[model samples]
Target chain A: MIKPLTGNYAAAWGARLARVGVVSAYPITPQTTIVEKLAEFIERGEMDARIIRVESEHSALSAAWGAALGGVRAFTATASHGLLYMHEMLWWAAGSRIPLVMAVVTRTIGPPWNIWTDHSDIMGQRDTGWLIMMSEHNQEVLDSIIQMFKISEDPKVFLPGIVGLDGFILSHTTEPVDIPDQDVVDRFLPERRQPYILKPGDPLIMGNIPSDLRDNVKMRWDIHRSQERAKGVIRDVDREWAKLTGRSYGGLVERYRCDNAKYHIIGMGAWVGDMKEAVDILRDMGYGIGLVKVRYVRPFPGEEIAETLASSKGVIVFDRSVSPGSAGPLYLDVLSHAYIHGVRVPIQNVLAGIAGIDVGYDDIIGGVTMFINALEEGRWPLPSKIQWYFGGGEWWP
Target chain B: MSTERYLPLARPVVGVSGKTGTWRIERPVINYSKCIKCGLCWLYCPDNVIEIVEGSAEYVKIDYDYCKGCGICSNVCPTKAISMVPEG
Candidate 1:
């Protein structure tokens, strides 16, 4: 059934449908409403889950980690400073191979302290070993959360997952989201069974003894192999979800009209929606423009991305997170992929909408113009090119 | 009731093999020539892993089976009387 809902509400509903047994979280902007809705569900007796009130994001994640280790389907939500506070446990959760899911409401990390949307918060944890998936809209956010549980909990890929949505852009914005029936969701996602749960009669140790070099290498190798297994799990989960819900999503990377297009713009999160609008506008005006929205950021589907951009005459990468002294994180990944496969497509980088500033129609248009101009001149622009002000300095190259 | 600190279970399978491997305690070898009744190893051993016979401090030896190899006694010996070596 379709309902008008914000991304936070959609996530709450998705968690409900998945039958998450433990919900541990600390309130943080953009993601606060998500836990509020879950609390309401518990109070109304609509969902049966343990709601834990924690002192900080650290405890929230830790509690979730413990509960998941106890063989329960666990979840948590955080944003900006809160996510960073739980930073170390992110690796702990992933390294322990706990199949827990988290909703990271992407907000700008700050010194001035902003509560608005940006990719910096989630971007800071790019190497934490979690299966990171970005959502473009409320429906995708909702759907991906439920789907992430399936993919991450697969025996072959028992890795933790994080579903990231822009802080205010998608989290607070109201949109039409199809809330699947509980029975249908149940049919899709069955009860979780973790082989490591502690029992009275049967006991075992969890997350202990990283003894020596061989053990460390073997454990990390197991994580890497499990992560590689997630790629196929992602595709299979999306396929099964579509069979159940009649809605299909692009598994790892989504393509928008790249059949015969010369230029392909690549990005992720809510900004992909803005880029789509830009692509639609430019396509109508007779510009052979296309787009590729990367959904899974970690275990980054590098080969698939390289193959898609191989035929494009020009490419443009938009990153909302800056990597200080290096290229923007997303652009750097794309550029590195292109370089690895020897894809000789000229590319332009646009670093815009940082620190909770929203990426709107204007930024998309400007990015398109930069791509078009660069393509016409046959020159891939260097760093610090085609910048947007967004409360700072705007310099055109 | 006063609660006792948590002690690791002593399953027989884990006997001396597990004890030496599981705990950080290393066995201290006392060179008879190097020993001069310093008695520092027994005084500083946190787990009481060292046994010193006679108040004269003339004889000292480590109980390898019980000692958690913390290496504390090696640092406290005034005359470099004790040295630690890994369990066999």
Candidate 2:
């Protein structure tokens, strides 16, 4: 059934279709409506599940972790400071290897107190061992959440995952989403088969302290290995989902019109849509330009990124958050991947949309034009390390 | 099929099969004459080593094999019939 729904409601529909057993959440910005819809479903008898009202984001994730550990499918959602509050439990969930899913509405972290969209909150949690994937639109938001459960619960990749969409941009925006039937979803995602579960008669000891340093090191390494293995599972799940629903988001990263392009713009999340428009405008003006949308950021997709950008003369990386003193986080990863694969294309880091400043196609096109001019004039690398685009006026500290 | 990297879901052995009594520095001796059938010591024992044997001379017996000599039973006893004596 096709319905005009906000990204939040689409996420709720995704969880409902997946038949999540327990949902533990605390209300926050764009994420509140996602759980609110879940509550409505439960109250209206549309869904059968336990909704845990938590005191804080910490308790919210902790309760979800407990439920997943107790051998049931679990979910939760949060944004910005709420995600920060649940930081410690994020590591616990991943380290414990619980196959749970969380929807994070990407928001700006505040001292100035803003609830706008940015990648800082989710980017800050890049190292927490959770498989992170960003969505470009409302439909992707729903589809990614469903795919996340299947990927996370795979025995080869028994790890938690985070599905992130830009705050307000996708979360509050209304778009037509095709909600699949529950029976079709059931056929796609069967009952979770975990290697271990907490049961009454069969008591189990989990999360015990390791007695040896070697054992501790090995456990952490195992998580890393599992994440590497998850790439295959992600692709497989996407293939199966496409076979069912006729939609597939080209595995790790989706390359748009890159076959004959000389310059490429790389980005993730909602801004990718804006970048695509910019690419089209530049292409019509006889500039061989294209866009590469990064779907999954955690496993990094280094090989796919390197392969896609190999033919481009130069690449502009648009980052929504800054690493401060270093280049943008996404830029850094792209550079490292390119270097590893021996693809030495001149890459420029354009920091845009920090603190949720409105970044449109015009600003994106202007950034690409600057990169193109530099590449043509033999002035590649353009003096300064990072370029700030669309920040009102440049006030350097 | 337990890997050294992750915890196996199987239950850890419940009772200590190894003789934990070797770690006991002191043992509790019960005075049955003053002992009431309240069973407070059995409930208070941390290691669950104290068992109630109805027909025995003293209604309660401590299995020293698993007792750690914590003296929790002596501390909780209301009648003052149990004492922690140094192990020779």
The best candidate in terms of lDDT: 2
Superposition error at A260 for model 2 (Å): 0.4
Maximum-TM-score candidate = 2
After superposition, which runs of candidate 2 have C-alpha atoms over 4 Å from their true positions? A390-397, B1-11, B14-88
Query: What is the fnat score of candidate 1?
Result: 0.00
Error of 2 at A117 (Å): 1.5
What are the per-model numbers of colliding residue pairs? 4, 0
- Candidate 2 residue-wise lDDT, A1-397, digit = tens: 9999999999999898888989999999979999999999999999999999989999999999899999889999999999999999999888888899999999999888999999999998898889999999999988998899999999888899999999999999999999988888889997886657787887677766555667667767888888888889888988999999999998888999897989899999999999999999999998999889999998789989999888889999989999988988999999999999999888999888989999989888877887799889988768764888765444222
How far is A322's C-alpha from truth in model 2 (Å)?
Answer: 1.8
Residues forming the 10-long window of minimal summed lDDT in candidate 2 chain A: A388-397
Fnat value of model 2: 0.45
Tens digits of per-residue lDDT, candidate 1, A256-298, equal 9888988888889998888999989888888898999999997
TM-score for candidate 1, please give it: 0.82
After superposing all C-alphas onto the true structure, candidate 1 shows an RMSD in angstroms of 9.4
What C-alpha lDDT, on a 0 to 100 scale, does residue A318 get in candidate 1? 83
